[model samples]
Target: MITGGSSGIGLSVAHDVARRGASVTLVARNVSRLEKAQQEVELTMSKLSMDGKVQFFSSDISGSVKNISEMVKNAEASLGPVYMLINCAGFARAQKFEDLSPDLMKQMLDINFTGPMVLTQEVVRGMKVQQEGGVVVFVSSQAGLLGLYGFSAYSASKAAIVRAAEALHMELKPHNISVTVCYPPDTDTPGFVEENQTKPIETKLISEAAGLFKPEEVAKKLVDDSLCGAWSSTVGLEGFMLTTLCAGMGPITDAASFMAQVFLSGLFRSVSAFYLWSFTRIVEREHKKRLENKKSE
Candidate 1:
């Protein structure tokens, strides 16, 4: 079961899962898009000649727990027990701290962090009862690892997911349930496009350093890492460096990752300092330019 499965990374994950011969239940708020995504997944199933069923439930992830629980119950009834629960339904709105509204902050917390956290609670209850352990994935962001300019609210929400997933990884380890949190870089998605519109110049410059990725690429890595029971899922060289550098007290899913984090910590710190310096320069330059324009006015 994938939330936000109607479009973007969520939809891409649905296609990948469908091709793997797994029955899928897509959850999203847009009924029309959900219908289209269902058709797309069914098409993938047909091409693979898989007998897996495809269904969709249109609902908001930020809605009440009662409604979310019902959504899960109905999904399982249609597609059997959920072996994997991927929380991919989230959005971002980049704005400077002073420009943000109280409502926007609450919305960010509700949709990005609380919604997935609540849904995970419902799904894990059944997962623990079933003999087959489950995989729970949270799709966080690169900004979650390091705060970025113009992403005050957005970064805070995504960062919360990372911390929660870390605790969950420990608790669910004994239950044979692996929780993976994926920190995807700027991906080419509808949400990313919308987010860019509100981004400050400094934020754009700093974020561009990480480079953009495709939804399919991010989805593939996310699904692969979750299935492998890897605690941290990330893409690109920058992503590897960030995850490794910020992997303090995180679950050591593999010996290799642990070794890399241990050995490369110093080198990554040196690199991060350079990156931080450049980001500060960008912010100062932008501020100066705005001030000059105001003087001219």
Candidate 2:
């Protein structure tokens, strides 16, 4: 089961996993978009000649706990017990802290944080009852690791996901359930396009250094990591360094990864300080330019 499975990373994951013969239930809000995504998934399955069932549920995941619960129940009933639940239905509205509206903040928390939490609760209940164990993947962001100038609300919401997944990892391990949280850098998606419209100059400049990734690339890595029961999934060198630096009490199931984290974390931290300084300079320069323009006016 994948939330936000109608597009972006979620939809790509659906295609990759389905190609690997996993039945998928895509949960999204727009019926038309869901239908379109379902068709795309079906086409992929056909091309791969994989016998995988693809279904979709059109419902607002952040709206009601009861409704989401019913939706999950229905999905499992139709698609069989969900072996994996990927929380990928989220959006970002980048703006400066002073410019962020109250409603927008609430919306971010509701959609990015609360929605996934609620859906995971509902699905995990079934996972526990079945006693078969399962995988829960949370699609967090790079901002979740390090807060950025224009992403106050978004970073807060995504940061919640990282901590929640960390706690869930410990709790679910006894039940044979594994939780993997992915920290993906900016990806080429509809959400990224929308986010860029209001993204602060500092935020944009800082993130650009990390580079953008394709949804398919991120999805493939996420799926493979989750299947391997990795505690954290990251893409590229930047992502790996950030994950290691910010790991902080999070589960480290792989010895080699742990060793890398311990050895490279300090070096990365020193390198990150330079990036932090550069971002601070950008913010200050932008602010000064705005002030000078106001004075001229």
Candidate 3:
């Protein structure tokens, strides 16, 4: 089951996973978009010559927990037990911290953090009942790893998921269930386009350094990592470095990654300081430019 499966990374993952012969149930708020996504996934499955059922459920994930639980129950009734739950339905509203409204902050928290947590709770209960462990994937952002200009609310919401995933990993490990949280850099998606409209110049400049990724590329890496039971899935070198540097209290089951984290954490921290300094300079320069323009006017 994939939330936010109607578009962006979620839809892309639906295609990839369906092609690999896994039935998928896409959950989203827009009925029309979900229908289109279901058609797309089915078409792709046919092209790949893989027989997998593709279904969709339209529900506002930020709604009541009972509603979300019912949605999952219906999905399981149709598709059998959910072996994987992907929490991908989220959005970002980037703006200066001072300019953000309390409502916007609450909405961001509800959609990005609470929605996923609620859905995960429902799915995990089912997994426990069946006594068949499953994989849970959270599509967190690079903003979650590091705070940036114009992303105060977004970063806070996403950062919560990373910590929550860590706690879930430890608690569910005994049940044979594993959790994977992906830290994807900015990707080319409808959400990214919308986010860019509100992004400050400094935020854009700082974010561009990480480069943009395609939804398909991000989805492939995310699905593969989740299937492999990786604790964290990072898109590129920058993301990998951030994950290693921010390896706070998560479960690091891979010996190679653990050794690398131990050896390179300090080095990465030094490099990250330089990056942060550059970002700070950009913010200062942009502010100065704006002030100068205001004075000239």
Worst 10 residues of 2 by lDDT: 198-207
Q: For candidate 2, give the lDDT of residue 177.
A: 96
* Residue 154 displacement (Å), model 1: 0.9
Tens-digit lDDT track for model 2 on 184-222?
999999989988998888788888988999999999999
Instruction: Point out the worst 10-residue segment of candidate 3 by lDDT.
Output: 248-257
Question: Which digits, one per residue and each the tens of the lDDT, describe model 3 over residues 1-297?
Answer: 999999999999999999899999999989999999999999998998987999999999999988998998999999899999999989998899999999999999999999999999999999999857899999999999989999999999999999999999999999999999999899999989998998888999999999999999999999999999999897888998999999977798788779889999999999999999999999999999999999999
In model 1, residue pairs whose N, Cα or C atoms come closer than 3 Å (at least 3 residues apart or on different chains), thus clashing, are none
- lDDT per residue for candidate 1 within 161-208, as digits (tens), equals 999998999999999999999999999999899888988889999999
Q: Estimated TM-score per prediction?
A: 0.99, 0.98, 0.98
Superposed Cα deviation of residue 208, candidate 1 (Å): 1.0
Q: Residue 92's C-alpha lDDT in candidate 2?
A: 95
Of 2 and 3, the candidate ranking higher by TM-score: 3
| C-alpha lDDT (0 to 100) for residue 222 of candidate 1 | 94
The parts of candidate 1 lying over 4 Å away from their true place are: none
